[model samples]
Target: MQIDWVTVAAQIVNFLVLAWLLHRFLYGPITRAMERRENAIRTRIEEAEETREQAEARARELEQERAELNARREEILEEAREEARRLKDRLQQEARAEVDELREAWRAELDEDRNEFLAAMRTEAREGFRTLADDALRALADTTLTERMAEAFAARVGDLDEVDAERLRGAVRRGEGLVITLGSDVSGALRGTLTAAVRKAVGDEVEIDIPESSDDFTGIRLKAGGETLDWTLDAHLDRFADRLASAFPTEDARETQDDDANGGRGAGDSTLGDSHGGTAAGGKGQASDAREGAAGDG
Candidate 1:
């Protein structure tokens, strides 16, 4: 129970020394290491935060790119649709044009065919009529036609226009005479009458000659050197046939014949009607002459 002051004091001093050693060697160094660890952890946390922020920014950029790509795809699709529509319309227009062209060509060909057929029919008709008339007239021909035809032909020379008269004069001048061709021999009286008529029509200086021809045409041919005028029944018939041909000409011939037919003498006014009348009258008269000749021969 009594206090030991030196021992107590020594114990207190040792305890103080131990505390100071721990603070300098162990506690101070441990405290410094803890602070350094704390600082390192803080730096690592800041770097992790920075990395996360960068990742978030990158994600936002990717989303924006995806949106842009979708918009561009839509635009391309619309453009493609418009181009297809344009191409379809162009093709349809071309087909329509081709169809129209073909139709026009077909119509033109049809018209040409029709024109050709009509022309052929007209030609056939003309040829058929000419053949029939020639056969009928030849069958009905008789001897008394000689004088009547000669008289009629001689009178026709007097009725010639200035152009025909001039042509005859030139031909006569060249040949030095006028030649009268007959279908058959005529009586001296008829010959004299025809000779007088020719002298009256032509100049008195002209000579008249009658020649025998083998052709069966019942008409006259007046020739002067190279120029010969056909005033025969065959010629008249040919002219009539020509008129018939002209009246119903083909499509190609109508334009030419229309102008000629309108300007020149028609079938009725020209020698066509007159020639037929003469032929008919001469045939009847020749039939009567045949009866008389037969009676005389008997």
Candidate 2:
């Protein structure tokens, strides 16, 4: 342990010098490099946060677009369905109207056919009855029947009204001359009787002309000017035909005949009956009486 104060001071100076060099060269450079690295890391973190927020905003926009598209699709589908329903209703209505029109046309055709058939049947029946009656009358006719008819004609002339008598007288004065038409020739005695009756009714100077027997009719017709007196079997048969026609009238005529019947009007009167010397009812009775009397005399 000798005294070493100088050696201690030299060692303290060396240690101080070494500390200063290490601080200047190592500690100062390391601190600056660490601060730069920290700043770069903070910038990178801020960029990442901004990118994430942008991505979230884009996702929200895409979701909204998808929702709008879905709504549009639903609306389109609903519109299509409504249009289809409307079209179906219109088609069904048109089809029903066409079917109704066809049915109505068929019904009208059937009605027309039915009316035609009925009219044909009526015409055939009327003609057949007329033919049969004509044959029966021809078979029953005889000379005696002709004489009785002539007698009936003479009686009818005697029963003429004043108006008819005056008309005949006027026609004779005008020189039209009376014409007596007969269905068949009568005996001389019957002719004379008819002639006497005509002279008694009119003036004896009145000319009476009797033509040859005509096959066109089966009755007696007396013509003077425009007036004619018919007392023919054909006239009686025409009244009967009128009655038959009224009984079996066509659809249109039946309605009118029914109306007239309800009004208490006779259906048997016709132009043929009017042409005779009496009303239809009176002529019918007289015709029946004449036939009976002729038959009894035969």
TM-score of each: 0.34, 0.40
Give candidate 1 regions above 4 Å deviation. 1-70, 139-158, 167-298
C-alpha-based local distance difference test score of model 2: 0.69
Clashing pairs in 1: none
Each prediction's whole-model lDDT (CA): 0.65, 0.69
Query: How do the residues 108-199 of candidate 2 rate in per-residue lDDT, one tens digit apiece?
Result: 67557755655554556444544555466567763355676788788877887676678778878888888888877777787788878888
Best by lDDT: 2
lDDT of 2 at 90: 94
Q: List model 1 lDDT by residue over 199-224, tens digit each.
A: 77667778888776534555566655
Clashing pairs in 2: none
> For all the candidates, what are their Cα RMSDs to the real structure?
14.7, 13.3
Candidate 1 weakest lDDT stretch, 10 residues: 286-295
In TM-score terms, candidate 1 sits at 0.34
